[model samples]
Target chain A: MFDLKPYLEVQRQRVDASLKSYLGPEDASNSRVTQAMAYSVMAGGKRLRPILCIAGAQAVGGDHEAVTALACALEMVHTYSLIHDDLPAMDDDEKRRGKFTCHVQFDEATAILAGDALLTLAFEILATTASQCQAAEHPKWLRAIGKIASAAGCNGMIEGQMRDIAFEGTVISIEQLEALHGLKTGKLIQASVVSGGMVAGASEIQLQALGAYAAHIGLAFQVADDILNVTGDPERLGKATGTDQARGKNTYPLLIGLASSQHLAGQLVDKALNALAAFDKKADPLRAIARYVVERNR
Target chain B: MFDLKPYLEVQRQRVDASLKSYLGPEDASNSRVTQAMAYSVMAGGKRLRPILCIAGAQAVGGDHEAVTALACALEMVHTYSLIHDDLPAMDDDEKRRGKFTCHVQFDEATAILAGDALLTLAFEILATTASQCQAAEHPKWLRAIGKIASAAGCNGMIEGQMRDIAFEGTVISIEQLEALHGLKTGKLIQASVVSGGMVAGASEIQLQALGAYAAHIGLAFQVADDILNVTGDPERLGKATGTDQARGKNTYPLLIGLASSQHLAGQLVDKALNALAAFDKKADPLRAIARYVVERNR
Candidate 1:
């Protein structure tokens, strides 16, 4: 079995160091907004999306250094979403990743601006970073950036939140629930994986396989999230566990029961791993990630 | 001496027709969020940024079709800013463009999501549209996108917004207020003009001239806005007069009296016109726009 922990940590440390440079200064002038942005990012999550981007690139024999920018961009998008999702207008949460949420720490308007800034910064990073690449790769940069945008845009994650809001407290079909999760959490995860592959200059066959792998793993990650929401330790999870059920949220566990949700996550992981069969040991991280998604304590 | 009304109208109609297509469908599943996004964009405004983009490209001899994507992208960013700025947590405005604000028409959460969606869609349009361009233009696309992102990101509009919020009900000097508006409103306006120029592969000299022109017009536009807030007819202005005073918001008229403010606006316009000395009638739109900015009723 591959020891994925150290690999994840190594990338985590690297991203953490560079993310600050990309963020520029929290100067005395714009300190409040910059502080909120840095606070939210540095509060810490698994950095899962970025690590996935790196692994995907590695699996395709691509340069990890070249893909670092894309990985950071993905993480920024995830960070922005979390900040917005925790706002008084959305989930109304006061804490995130073991710290006061952006709105709670800074004022609400500052939080909103911080989220806006972070989201805008993601594209800025992608565009500027791509400029450093050879002229031949410019089209790929545009395509990759577009994919990231769509995954996070109206028809993707935002729409999923809209549907969730519309469907809250109601029993939704497995398909409806699946589709909702697929958009909310799954799409970005898929984007994270596929973005890495694209940066690595993936061939059509490799891209397809990566897509399949991403699709399966994305759902598994969400399913596991739902399960953790119900049963995981709040301390480890860095959030209260029962809010989903309390809010009558539409989730895999809520729709099909916790046991079934767990089983579904397992099945999805199996599919995710199978999709990577064509790759040799080079894809060990991808395989390990799928398993870890269902097995993570947090 | 150019008649800008007809020229502005022609581009407005073209952009309005295509803007809807960029927003995608108000699908039944995500109708609430999609509706909010559509409603916000469709609500009438000058579409100044988009027109600036088109004018910038035209002045540099670029293809209109190629730059239309960027034109729409600028509009979307503008729309998103308006939506967020009106939220209860931000400007807390009840109305905009003589209509109920997005939060008023569609709850705070939906409004928030709509703003986020619009922002994301801008990048999506840039990426996807740039994909259709010739390979040689790919780097230009990245540069253009990066410029847009920087103009709108934390160091730009959002940071400016942060300052505006912090400075509300507090006094600020002319220089401070100028710097604030320069970032808040001016950067994106500058980006709008420059993005079109970049798409057309502007020579460095032409780009610098456009920059100087944009800088002047941007400040002149804001100065005119401050004058109008205190003096213009309420109906023509769309929003109420003296709200800036009511809110203690800083403005040129407040800082330096209406007469001086108007004088400053004219001077800026003259400077903007002077910046175009190197270009011929190809920049007629740019010249006309500077005049219109300080002269328009609203």
Candidate 2:
């Protein structure tokens, strides 16, 4: 065993610290929007996207410092999505990570502005980072930014969210459900991994391999999420169970049965691991992460 | 004297066509969110920001084609801000540009998503444009992106929106009102002009002049807006008049008398025109636009 537990703990702690530093300290002079942004982002999650970003960079022999800004940007985008998704107009979620959601803590208007601020800040960070780099490396950062934006933009996560909203309370085929999840969740995950590689100057072949690995793990991650929604402890999950079912939202388990969903997740994890066979121990975190994606309780 | 009417009309049409092209064609496969986005973006407006961007580039001897994507990106960002500002949780407005607001035409959730999609797309276009540019010009594009992002990010438009909402129904000082609008509206407008100059490789001195010019015009524009809110025709303005008074929102005319506010706007426009002293006929449009900002009925 590669001791994935300790590895995850260390990476999560590092990302958490970097995120706090990147967001900077909050004084009384800080606006309510900034406070809300800090509150939501610091409210704690698995930090999965940022951790994957770091791992992707590391797999190509890049250092943690090299991807710190990029990782923080990814986390900011993820946090913004959560804030907006939890709004009254969307999921109407009152709590997340066992804390009051942004809109619940602040007003709905503040929450919306906070989400907008975070999304804009993500690009600010990206553009600032690219500007700071040497001219030779500027293209890499720009390419990574493009990847992240596409993953978050109309044809990717946003479109997926639209479809998800439209499909609510209605049944769709398994393929459609998979495609939806692929857009909503899988694309960002794929971007996280591939962008890290891109910033690290990964070869085209390596980038393709990382993309393949991420695609598998991304779907597996969502499938595990569906399973957790039905079977996990609410306390551990920091949210109520069966939200998808209650909303009449489509899920892998809902369409394919729980057993098949679990099997499919396991198989995806295996495929993800296989996609990383060319890399040495440097890719251990990615490999361990794929396993953790399916096997973790929450 | 410069014939600003024909100039403005021609530039507006060019920007309108470019915006349509940038957004691309809508088809049956498009999601409802996309439809809502198109519906709101295609609604009638002055197209001021994009025009300023194009003018800024031209002032630096850059052709229209050179800054087309950037101009479209600025318009998209401006449109996204308008959409969000009209949301029920924010302005709660029912109409904008003589049409039903995004939240009114579509649902609140769809409107929110459309705004988000447009914001994300703006950055996508910026990053893609930077990526497509020659390596020699890449730094300038990245710099422009940094400037735009900072103008639109936490300490910029979003914070301004937060403060605006917080100040609703509460009287504030003149300085506070000016500061609020400076961030909320002035910053993006400044970025529009400066980013255009930047993409066209304006010298540092030229950029500073453009910045000064934009700052003066930006504040003048808002002062004029306050005057219009108090005095303009409801049908001409698209939305109702006296909305500032209805919301108890602070305005120039509220802080000072209407005649004094008008005087202040003319002074600011004069300052804006004086800021362009170094430029020749190429800067005529900017000078004319500054006058238009204060003189327009709408």
Poorest stretch of ten by lDDT in candidate 1 chain B: B22-31
Error of 1 at A264 (Å): 1.3
Deviation (Å) of A174 in candidate 2? 0.7
Evaluate all candidate structures by whole-model CA lDDT and list the values in order. 0.88, 0.88
List residue ranges in candidate 2 displaced over 4 A. Answer: B26-29
Q: Candidate 2: lDDT of B169?
A: 90
Question: lDDT by residue for model 1 over B1-298, one digit each (tens)?
Answer: 7789999999898888889887655555446788889889998899999999999988887746868889999999999999999999889999998999999998999999999999999999999888998888888888999999999988899988988998999999999999999999999999999989999989989999999999999999999988989988889868899899998999998889988998999999999999989897889998999999988843
User: Scoring only chain A, what TM-score does candidate 1 earn?
Assistant: 0.96
Clashing pairs in 1: none
Cα lDDT tens digits for candidate 1, A159-231: 8888888888787898998898789988898888888999789987988888899999998888888899889
Q: State in Å the error of residue B265, model 1.
A: 0.3
True interface contacts reproduced, per candidate: 0.97, 0.73
TM-scores, one per candidate: 0.98, 0.98
i-RMS, every candidate?
Answer: 0.7, 0.8
